[model samples]
Target: MQSPGIPRSREAAPAGWRETADAAIEGGDDPVPSMLTALLRRPATAFSMLAVAVLLGHAAAALLIAQLPRASFGVEAIEDGMIRVTGDDRRYAADAPVAFVGSDGRVRLARVMEDLVPELEPRGSSSEITAIYAERDRIAALLREPGLMLRLPDGRQLPAAVRPGRIETLSSGFWLSFGIALCSSLAGLWALVLRPREWAARMFMLSGLGLALGAITIGALEQVSLATGSRTLFWITHINYLSAYIFGFAIVALFARYPRPLIGKALLAGFAAAQGAIWVMGLLKLDVDMLGIQIFVVLLLALLAVVLAGVQGWLSRYDPALRASFLLIWISLLLSMGLFSIVSLIPQLMGSPDIVPESVSAAAFLLFYLALAVAIARYRLFDLGSWAVNVGLSALVLIAVLAVDLALVLITGGTWTVSLAFLTAAILWLPLRELVLRRAERRRDKRDLLLLRGASEVAFAPRPEQQTVLWSQLLDRQFSPLTIAPVTCDTAAIRADGRILAIPSPLGGTGLVLSYANQGRRLFNSEDRSVATALVALVAEMVDARAAYDRGARAERQRIARDLHDDVGARLMTTLHRGDLETVHADVREAMADMRLIIDGMSDQPRRLSDIVADLRHETVNRLVLARIHAHWPITAIFDDERLVDALQARVLLSVTRELVSNVIRHAGAGTVSIRCALTGNSLLLAVRDDGRGFDVDSDTILGNGLRNTRKRLEELGGSMAVQSGPGGSVIEIGLPLPSREQGMSDRSMAV
Candidate 1:
């Protein structure tokens, strides 16, 4: 049941759970039921259910409003303690007490009826009124005229100040409250659905529930007050206060838990109990003054909670994403509450009518919910620190743009402010912001590059112990871990402390364990893990490569030892047994020279053809002189001195030359030997001719060990050797192709 591409190992899920996880991963089973089960298991499910209930309640309220009978009567005119109204009498009763408007254009409660006596006349001639009246005597005194207009309870206008549209007002308030409640509930449900395990998310769900309840109660209170024409709606007020208490408690809880909880469980529980007590008091309709004091206490506690949360967040070293999310939440809370506070304070300060209504203030809570939702859903939750900075910069730019636009508008008295603001932002602010952001990004990139370079050094480290030390240093620099030690774990994983990361050892045996970050800093993030994974992979490759190289080197050394024992050892033994002291000495000297050449060949330095030719000529002449033979050395360098040859080619060429000279001296009884070196086109040619008794080229006996090894070496170097043997002389010709400049560089790099 394991998924394709996912490895099956002991590190994977346990036996019972593995199959289900694999099925889900492999897309072979329905995962929704399991997911739903998981969601329902969390405490947030209760809040989610509450949200759904709130939504359904709103729907029911809407349906009830639709089924109700419509109001009919409207105010027409006022005259001599009497009011004239117009509407369909069949639908409306004659004596029904309805909402009315007097001369001053204010709504009031009054009885609308058909006149019993027909002598009453309209009084007022002016459309404007001096004042509103609640009593009949005052209303009659003011309504000695009939030119004033009024709106009816059903939202119809009349000539006189008559019945105000109470029904219409109630309908508007109900729908607005219902919409706010529905949205708040949905936001709560969404937070719970997204991250049920998060305590902050649970608190947010409760906050949304509180907001919905508060909106509903407040809206209902407004509707009932309008319908009954009474301000003493004590029961509705109590419910409203209860909802407010719940809302304040939830908001404080959410703030305390957000990003990460700093408050203790006992303290949180105590706070919750106090809020619950306040709610109970409101439910019991306690003394108004006592209720007010409790409500103020709840508000103060919420404010205190917010302040503590802010302090904790500011002091803590959060990862980038958490920092950004916290900043966003802070901004959302501030804007929502700040705007509402401003709206409330402005009217009192200036003694003017309220510019923003209560209904609009209720909708501002949505901002905080929306911000929480975004933070939860985002992929890089801990890396949004840069985003917070950008948000601040953008806000500043916007404010500046607005200020400039206003200034220009006021100065020119024209509609050029918008265009000017756009130009200013495009030409100045945007580019500046981009430059600053790019610089910040470059700093981050530089830090990453430093880690990469350190990893590279570890990869090419000369020893396993050095590699381990370097790797530890790299982790220390990148993550500031407190300690790094070898562990027995075979798989990469996060440790129990949450700050430690365990990476399986690349060198095999004990794995590596990185402890907590230094100074009790923030926990290790995904980005740090990703970088560590890359380092581990690189080190693994290096270890594998080094192992393969050691294996190949051991095999090569064994082959060389076997060859030396079989060929050179036998020759020296035979010479020693025959009591040929001079030949024995010569053989030992040649063996020592060959060993030196082998050592030289192992070096990575590049050799030039001219230098190699000179060394070969010297060795050849010395050997010929030792054999008491005349030597003719006519060598002409046809290639440039800078033309480099690799170690392999130098080794092959030297080996072949030594073999040819030894053959001419020890086997061929040559009196004189001639050597010629020249360059032909892109090839280097070397010919050695000796005036000695030549062997037959076609004879099988003529192919000795020396001749075979010479031919093999030439062939390995991408060259060819030809032997021409006769009675007069024997000639050996070898040709090797020269590599181009680019090829030489490539070969040189490969040698390194």
Candidate 2:
């Protein structure tokens, strides 16, 4: 139906259109800057810029990490004013209140928290006021020294060494954070570059950018604090909060206006303005309470608002496609945001240990950005078909295998870890693969059956228009589109963000447009488009077959009409005017014989050429004898095993023989008539010669009805007739094409 990944606004092109549309922006194209316009025009350029920005962000995080001192000392916050040391390469006193003294003789306090910040005690609690901004800056400055002097409770000072390397010193948590940020930003950038001016796309890009910046700040801060026991920098913590607030608001804004606008832009603007104002106030310490549980509560509220906005969006839309797109975004928001919250944010607010590391959970945000890009663009724009499922499953298996290998390395440190991981994954995947394939097979079978039944109904339709009607019905039954109408589209495409599906006609005109699929419950997705495309191709073949059938039917009717007029009518007329009973009986009998031959030919029952020749010769000789004319007909036994002919071909041959003999009997006035039949090459050749006072070949033969009908019948079967009529005699050499055995059988099957 369309290409995979994020597509441009308006779904697809019709005639003259840009891939990236800017009409949706405020003041239309006027508000879009020239530089942004140029970037949009060249997606590669936009991608390069975005990639550079992401790389720079990562580089800053990496550089900062390399600068930080590595204590390699695990710190767990036990309670206020104290900490407990866990696993470390260098053992310290088990119960020691250790303080790090930097080489600069500056002392730093170590406190561990999930976000690399000393947890701000609640205002009403015994802990009271949080650490002042000056104190936080002092702790941050002390941690900046290259290495630190470890001071334990026992008064034993240990010189902890530190090192620096851009990539080598980077921690695992940092990489996870980097991945989450990179993936999130790129997904959003795809949509933004494609549809920069589109509101939905803008909000989507904002959401991704926010997640990326937040992930980088949080990951860098947490990893640095975790490695070197130190308090989280105040500014970095504020940066994380800023990114989080922006991300939350952007999601809320996105859902508010996408699919169906749930709220006005003014309301969305107010939400954004409030976050900005509150963030500035918190940064200046004017609203200390707003920076603590208040921020989490605000984020939670924002998520809930997003859910509500999605619900309203769904309720407000009647178009199934649009609703479906909204639904995907909504569900993705809930799953990705929901998982990130439950495992990270929600737990932090609840004062419970996190279910998973925040860095690992942050990656969930990637799903939302990707989902938003596709849903807003047009959900299911691409039909990767079962291949999408295959790819997902393969990736899952690979991750599982990797996880197993890592686990094996940690648990047993075995050299066969890779082999064991692959073996385990293979064991699990083989059955899973069979199960998936079998399910797919079942679904495909049903679709194939539907196609077969539909094609038959269409191809065998009594009228051309009926075929069109049946074709429409088939599509309607398959997709259950709420609205279906004719549209002028040479090629099938999904348009209006899947509100309209254009399917090209099989009969070479514009096809029907289907909308509101599943009766307003879903959009016209790629699967629907694929089904429609396949049906169109199937119908094209069926239409061609129908046309061929109609042609054959018309030709058959004309052949039957000509046969009735030429042979039977002429015999019946002669029978009516006869005076003698014997002559009249003979005329009726000959007419009945002609009718029998015509019926046999029309019935598609092939007869042996030798038997037909013998029968015709018998009839011709009997007629000649009655007319007092000598008959000398020789049957060539050499041609009995010759090729067979179908009913129509047989009919033509019979008619030719009858017309020639009738001419000799009525007007030839010959003393002797000889008929010779031979099978030459792929033709059955026949010669009827009469030694009678023959008419002029150029004049009388042209006007003779009997000869004319015989020649016409022969020509109809792709046979030929040569009349060498003179004062001596007239000989008609007729050559009708003889069919091969296989072809004759096939033609017989299709004769009707």
Candidate 3:
């Protein structure tokens, strides 16, 4: 069954009823108007409509009062509680009776009819004869001319002529109170209409309604007292108490549910029973003292409930939103209570008149409700840590400001002390607050960075199992989930519990899961989710990179095996079969040199251009001397300024140079060879000229394997090679682009 103030859609109903309703609406029935009519029939909606009507009625009354004529009157003191007034003198008569107008705009006769009393002396009174003669002489002079005599209730005589003006100040206060009640009612209606399903929201609505009803009762009773000069209304006064009790109950209940409920069912039941008992006693007018005792007991219980709520909020460490909301509620309630005590309760307790108007208390209550409403509606439920921190710091600064003001007032006196205190506080407070906040933020940021760094380290772990272990450790340090285990479930669905995060395992599996139970009793927030996402992405990238590295290593080993089998293996076999020691030795040396080149090329270290040039010159000269050929390798500085080349580029350049020199000595039958290296623009230029019989150009001839490989290497390095051949001489020129300036400088620094 749906509650009167709750929506039907929120309550569970018979199967298919909602579906039928939806289908009927969708099939061109135009049920919106009907639906609205049904809504109006609900008790909650009817109550809200009534409240709106009441608000409009009060507004109209205020407008009517504004249209009334203005009246002014002069007041003069004649005696205690007596005044003489004269206005537009033509309106008053000498013998006419006069009246005074009250603040409710009602006028009553100021004169009282009573019998005159003759002065009598007590039998035991000591009367001096000279004093009695003087009093008799004064009385005889006043009796010379007899005029119309009148007496007031207090035995004081009224003035002969007087006038009264309209009184509206108290009327204005009543109207203001009515307006506050109207606003409270409307706010309650809004909360119920928007979120009637939530228990906390319902409690808030009830509190607002109670406050509105109480305000209305108090305002109306006070208004009647002002108009009729009677302040006692037994029935209506009890009704006011009932409304107050209801309001207090709802407020306590709301605190119990908000953030989290701390009180058990038994305590809640006890609270309800106490409130009911207090209400019954107040209604029956039985044992007034008992009623007071019941009220005090309920108050104490309510305070305990609020304290328990704060404790619960603190215990739920991960729910920053709840903690923040509770803190705001605590601050607002204490402030309101303090103001009420100072301005109203304390004065009344001390038998003094109220120093502040009742409207101050009304305003404080409104502020408390408004703050809670904002916190619930606007702040995210689990992600208010930063906001909570800021509010706490701001409160501290405010306290500091107040303390400074008080200290200055004590030391400097009232004469300009307030201004000086404010100035000093502004100068000192802002910088200190900024410094503390910055430091706090820096610490938080550092912690976040550590989480990221830990994840990155896990990404680079050598083994997949090791990565999982490290990832689990990172999660433990950060979130501290209750358990970590593999699950064959959907990895994309991330779930969380109080201080626990359920994330997909980095290792590939449908059911692999890593559950983290956090150390603090807090829930995983959006920030934790973001960090986890980044970690997963990094791990995926690192896994891909590792796979690529392994594949490349395998392919390189195959290429090395093929080169050794096809070149060195064949040459050594031929030399061994021919029984030629010199040929075998030469083949072994060439194989060793080839193996060294391959090893150097596979290394990650870079080589400088000058170093490569020197190595190339030395190797070419030694090869020529061993081959008994005149070599004119006049290669000098390759660059005017020193430059660094990466391993791949350097290997390609050296291989091509060495291959050209070897071809000249072994195949070309050249008597002499000249090598030159230089830089032109951003390109490195190498020229190898040989005085040997050159092959014919544009002929269909298969090039040697070494030449083919050299050409392929130059193409891969984004460079081109040109060959100019003739019977007299042949030249091979290679041009390669240099690295960018910044990269060259970085490499040079590293090399140095």
Candidate 4:
């Protein structure tokens, strides 16, 4: 696709250009006045001026084109010695047709071919023609045939067809005047009565655009039919008319984007979908007709009714922004349609009936653009200010183009001459405009700098002692965003012992500050109040985190204490009962010592109960040896209880703590180790919560034995222990409640 001498891709821009753009956006001082405010005041005036210029230019060009000689088209006939014309731009005259021999030695009917065909066709392509040439009375007979034809040199007949080319001349001045009137009416209505807003303006413009295009196309088609006898242009014109009908709905749908009702949204979506479908069908060569136009019109009218109803409902609710938006939109609709209707009448009055001209569409659009610009500049309609700016700039650029076009037309002698003139005019005008804008900008800059200097001078000026109160009052007045809570400031002053005044915050807290002049000076100079507010929020978050952590820590400690008392104390009491008075005393002392050790060890420790079970399993192996039970410990323990794990881990350990000691004094005759630890849901179980001399667990003495003590301890910790004792060594199981992950709380319910 690249030209032979051109590169496929241009090289990347140097970094300097990017930096300059950034600087422009950020470095501009007082951007509000520089951009937005300036635009709001001057843009409307500029638009109006440009519109006038374009109107003048187009009018001049049209007048010039009109002055050229008119051309004739289609067939001319002689019936009963009277001349009758039946094609486009028909003119009747009595004349005898004669074939003329050209210098090229070809015979031709020069007047009809040159004057008739070119005039009728007029470079307009989408036109149809169905003309016949015969004696006036015979013409009616030829018209009766379905396909009108022309006789060729070979005696063959061909169907009559005219292909109009690019541009067409306006055959009637009245029609042109009618178009001008319609446009003028719309513009006048827009200027005087319509609210200074956007939606109204846009709708007015779009409808005009659609109708104008429709009219132009229709006129071109008529031009073709006048040249060639065919119904093609007529059919194409009808299709265009249908499309224009949809364009009206498109304008209506735009207003639906405003926070409208459900019905409005549905209408908007449905209308858009229909338009899309129509476009797709058109692209696929599906021929739309007058019937299709009727169907779409009915649908659009229904949608419009629904939208208007919704708008009424919204108005009843009384939202000012919505009211403003809807009002503007409706105004646009009325202004455009009302003006269009009036202008459309002119053609009928002038005996050259057709659709309104394209210029009317532009005029309507200008109004719509103005209304929308008002919304963008003030109300931020659709939150689309950026898009509006771009579109506005484009319109301005279009004005410059029109200006260039004017210069080019003035210098027109040939294509090259016109092109050169256009380029030269643009180059000259652009620089001049830029220079004027820069000068205006400099003046604005000077004004802004002077104002800023004044503000800075007032800000930095020296003041007396009395002014400090006035200064604080002023700062408070201007900076209402900082609504500081009242706090007491204690100033240490005029006290022999140097006592500072304590200022209490109104809500709860207090602050102390010296009342010394130096302190006051520093306070006036400081601008770190924002930093203080941020620090307050941060500290609040940290306090919440700490409170949560402390609650968890407290719960953990309580559970551990309960476990130690139940497990270890019971075993120690048993030991004291079995010994003599002195020995019993010694045993008691030893138990007290062990209790102190467990409590001291746990003070700083935050281990979970499951981990303690694993440690207890290994410790129970040594206890078996110490107890001299000389029996198989066969310990397999699992701790899954939340409360019981923390509550009974120490108790479990204490029960096993001196099992080997007791066995040495009583039943354990052997001592190797076999133990395993695991955890499962809902229960913390110790297999060797006991392994000792074989005895009937149900016996009265054994029922109240150390085993009973262990069982009671287990029950207290929300656990149950069972002793399987007979002749072989015993196996004990302590089942305790497990922690619920949810609830995040230990269940201290007694073990069953």
Q: What are the candidates' C-alpha RMSDs?
A: 13.5, 9.3, 13.4, 24.4
True-vs-predicted CA distance for residue 213, candidate 4, Å:
8.8
**Runs with alpha carbons beyond 4 Å of true place in candidate 4:** 1-157, 161-224, 227-382, 390-615, 623-631, 635-685, 689-752
- Kindly list the per-residue Cα lDDT of model 3 for residues 1-752, writing each as its tens digit: 11133223322221233344345445444678568545543546655676778678666644543332222222222222234442322322223344433334344234311101111110111234224333433332322323312233333333322112133543555666676677776776555554545556677778777777666655544343111211123444556666666777776777676656655657766877777877776545442443344335445544654565566556754553345456565655544444444555454444443444565466655655565554443223234344444544554554455457657756865422456666887898779878987998999899878976886777778877888788778767766655556555433333422123346666565323334324434435557666667666666677777778888799678656655554456546655775657646665676677667778877847777778788877877877777777877664556334677787677677777877776676567788888888888767888999888886645546355666667776886677788888888789999877675466732223221
TM-score of each model, paired residue for residue: 0.49, 0.66, 0.55, 0.30
By TM-score, how accurate is candidate 2? 0.66
Tens digits of lDDT, candidate 1, 1-752: 22233233223212323343345445434677567545444435645675667767777655543432222323322332344444433233444344446566666435444321111111121121111112323333333344443344456655442233334445676678778878887877666655555676677777777777777765664443111211234444555666666766676776676656667768888977887786676444343444335546645755665685576468544443345566666655554554444443334334432334556667655645566555543334433344544554554565566567757867987653678887977898778868988998999899878866886788778888898788777777877776677777665665432346677766667777776554335444465667678777877887787779889799568646744654456456656765666667777777777777767765746787778888888888987887788999975644344577777777777777877888888778999999888877656788999989999777767777668767766775568999998888899999876666556531423221
lDDT of 2 by residue, 34-140 (tens): 54554455656766787898778777766775675554444554333244444433333334455677777766665322223344322322123344434444554
The regions of model 1 sitting more than 4 angstroms off are 1-190, 197-371, 374-470, 473-498, 504-510, 530-644, 671-716, 720-735, 741-752
What 10-residue stretch in candidate 1 is worst by lDDT?
125-134
- Over 1-752, each residue of candidate 4 has an lDDT whose tens digit, in order, gives 12232222211111223333345555457866457434433434434654676466545544543343222324443332233334434334443332223234454232322223222211111111222121211322333334445433223333433333333455453354336434533443233222233343444444444444444444344344343332343344455545456555644554444344334556666776776566455334333332343434534543573466346536633432334344444444444443443344233333332233444443544455455434422233322223334444444454445446545645763222436545765787689778978998998698556534433333333443332333233323322222222334432111101111122221124432222112221111121233223323433344455557778689657655654554356656567567466546545654664576466556543346656655555554544444443434343434553433333345444454344234333454433323333446755444542333566767887554455655665666666766666655655555656565553445444433
Candidate 1 scores a C-alpha RMSD against the true structure in Å of 13.5
Q: Which candidate is the best by TM-score?
A: 2
Score candidate 4 by TM-score against the native.
0.30
